[model samples]
Target: MNALTVNLRSVLELTDEQFFQLCQANRDLRFERTATGELIIMPPTGGETGNRNARITQQVMNWTDADGTGIAFDSSTCFKLPNGADRSPDAAWIQLARWNALTEAEKEKFPPICPDFVIELLSPSDSLKVAQEKMKEYIENGVRLGFLINRKSRQVMIYRQGKEVEVLESPATVSGEEVLNGFVLNLAMIW
Candidate 1:
């Protein structure tokens, strides 16, 4: 889905509570908060995009479930990165140790931690530049691994810590590498 970014820093700074309340009151739109306090208002995905996102999330969740090493999250779950940015990756997984360290109250709100792995599936309306920026932000926030998948161009930009991004063209699948251990995402459904 395409997102409408509102630069509220010029108008007024919103407290964490205010941002949380605003998000809760507008359940129709998906929201994200940047480290700079900009609000990203994303529209609901179209049917095709929604189905693709679901498949991606299901695949990741299946691996996480069987591996029993981490917890999987869908698009609706937001994570408050250590840098203070609230982001919602299309598919994400945090290591069991990291997740267990969170207090119950923190878990109830946006967990203040970065996921070990994250996936962003590009919808038709999504801007590639914006998505790339988001992926970079994830990496800067300490995400160990991230994937920016573009079905239109059949390309995937792979991001890993301490390495330059690796771009693939028309790949049939994406490997989880050492970070995800045994997880290998099958791209047939999403592609």
Candidate 2:
């Protein structure tokens, strides 16, 4: 299903705590906040999408465990971006130093720092244009590397800071490059 965006700036402005409480109350639903204060309600992904997402997250988690240089986060974790937007990427990783910098209280709420690496897998109901825009926003907010994987199209759009996006079509695998050290994502399971 497509995401629904609601502009509640006039009726009510949700503070950070209010938004967090709202999310906690609605445990089954996923929500996001735009930089402009709009609310986004995202529907749950289908079984196929969920399965693929699990594989992707598992790979990243394994890498993080072995690399010992960063922490991996699943899709359910929302981050409070530098630009005031609350976003949740499919799979994300933050450097150890950056994560250690946050106070215990800061870690209790939505993280206030952008991830060092992010992955957004396009599901059947996802919009490619919208996903691309989100990737750009991640880079602009200090993400070092990102992958927008469109499984239907078998295309992976690589996003890096200060560089043009690179598109790879039907690739067997995608490397994490220097960002994740020796990490490489195998596409066989995803495809």
Candidate 3:
């Protein structure tokens, strides 16, 4: 199913703590909040999508472990962006310094900072346009690099701060550039 969005700004403005409590109470549903106070409920992925997501997360996590310069996160980790939007990229990585700066409580809740790198793998229920918009939001919120990967289209949209979006068609691998430093994602597993 596609995501369902609810505009709750008119009735109630959810405080950060209230939102966190709401999320904690609803453990089964994945939720995201827009900067404008719209709540989005996302559906779970299918088997194929889940497998691909695992591979993508594993690769990034392994790289992060080896690189020793950053921390990696899976889809379940939501981050509170600078613009007040709560986002959870499919796979994400944050520089060690940025992550270390967070207080223990901040780290316990949705991280209060954007990731240095983010990857959004398009699932059957996801909209490419929406994913593209999210990538742009990441850049705007200080993400150094972002990728919107479409397996069906075998395409990857690379987003870099202060640079134009770059499209790669059927690339076997995509580099993390300076942001990730020596990390490369193998698209064959994702495809």
**Runs in model 1 with CA error above 4 Å?**
none
CA-lDDT, candidates in order: 0.92, 0.96, 0.94
Candidate 3 per-residue lDDT over residues 1-191, each given as its tens digit: 99999999999999999999999999999999999989999999999999999999999999999999989999999999999999999999998998999999999999899999999999988998898998999999999899999988899999999999999999999999998889999989999
lDDT of 1 by residue, 36-132 (tens): 9999998988999999999999999899989999999999998988888889999999999999999999898888889999999999999999899
What RMSD, rounded to one decimal, does every model reach? 1.0, 0.6, 0.7
TM-score for candidate 2, residues paired by index: 0.99
Global lDDT of model 1: 0.92
- TM-scores for every candidate against the unseen true structure: 0.97, 0.99, 0.98
Residues 101-126 of candidate 2 have per-residue lDDT tens digits of 99998889898999999999999988
True-vs-predicted CA distance for residue 13, candidate 2, Å: 1.0
Between 2 and 3, whose lDDT is larger? 2
Provide the lowest-lDDT 10-residue window in model 2: 104-113
Cα lDDT, model 1, residue 5: 85
Please report, as a residue range, the 10-residue window in candidate 3 with the lowest summed lDDT: 124-133
